[model samples]
Target: MKPTGGSVGGFLAAVTPARRQRDAETLTALLQDVSGREPVLWGTIVGFGSCHYRYPTGTEGDMPLLAFAPRKTASTIYLESTAEYADDLARLGPHTTGVGCLYIKDLEQVDLEVLRDILTRSLAWSEAGGSEQAELTVTG
Candidate 1:
């Protein structure tokens, strides 16, 4: 499927104007303080980082060091494998999750400290090879 946001604007453009403006401003400030760089476009996702991923099937791709997307239904944060961090999620405020996804009503509802910790861990995990990420998505 085509990415919601076009090339120049990136996925941020796909979100509603108000939400987009809010997320954009938040992301800009966050990245500046944390990652120290601006977000990049990953199709419809807003990503940060210089990391990449390679699969056992031989498919290889690059993604931001960290990334999140604001979709029509809900916002998605691609932190890391929920499988490896199940216990962390349990203590991470109120969140409903999936095999590889974390569903949150909005950024405010979740714990920012825990979220930042996860984001930091996810970057380290991604840099460490991301084998866990692939495993987290595999279903028997």
Candidate 2:
């Protein structure tokens, strides 16, 4: 999927209730700081920067360098690949993994430093074109 021209604030305001707004804002700031880019709303996700990828099937597209969604149940963090960061994930506090996403109930439930480390690693991987090397894994 490709990004749409939506406003980040509008999307956050729409999806996040007041209870979760602070966490969403915190994530936005952290992602922006780690990525060194501004945020863009891609559908319901808040994405920072972008990366281009071409698949083996001769398909290619641009995707967020980093992105996340503040869902009602949890905050979904879009990592480039969770498989490459087992050590980090092991110490990432309370969280779950699904393929490329890291799910946390809220910012308070996880360690921010660990989260930042993960984001930093993900950004580096994306920048280095390591997406194709990613192996999916599921863990909690």
Clashes of each: 2, 0
Q: Candidates' lDDT values, in order? A: 0.59, 0.78
TM-score of each: 0.72, 0.86
TM-score of predicted structure 1: 0.72
lDDT for 7 (candidate 1): 57
Q: Tell me which residue pairs clash in candidate 2.
A: none
RMSD of each: 5.7, 5.3
Candidate 1: tens digits of C-alpha lDDT, residues 45-124: 66665554556676755556666666655556666567767767776776667766666556666676776677677766
Tell me model 1's lDDT, rounded to 2 decimals. 0.59
Model 1 misplaced regions, further than 4 Å: 1-14, 17-24, 132-140
lDDT of 2: 0.78
The TM-score of candidate 2 is 0.86
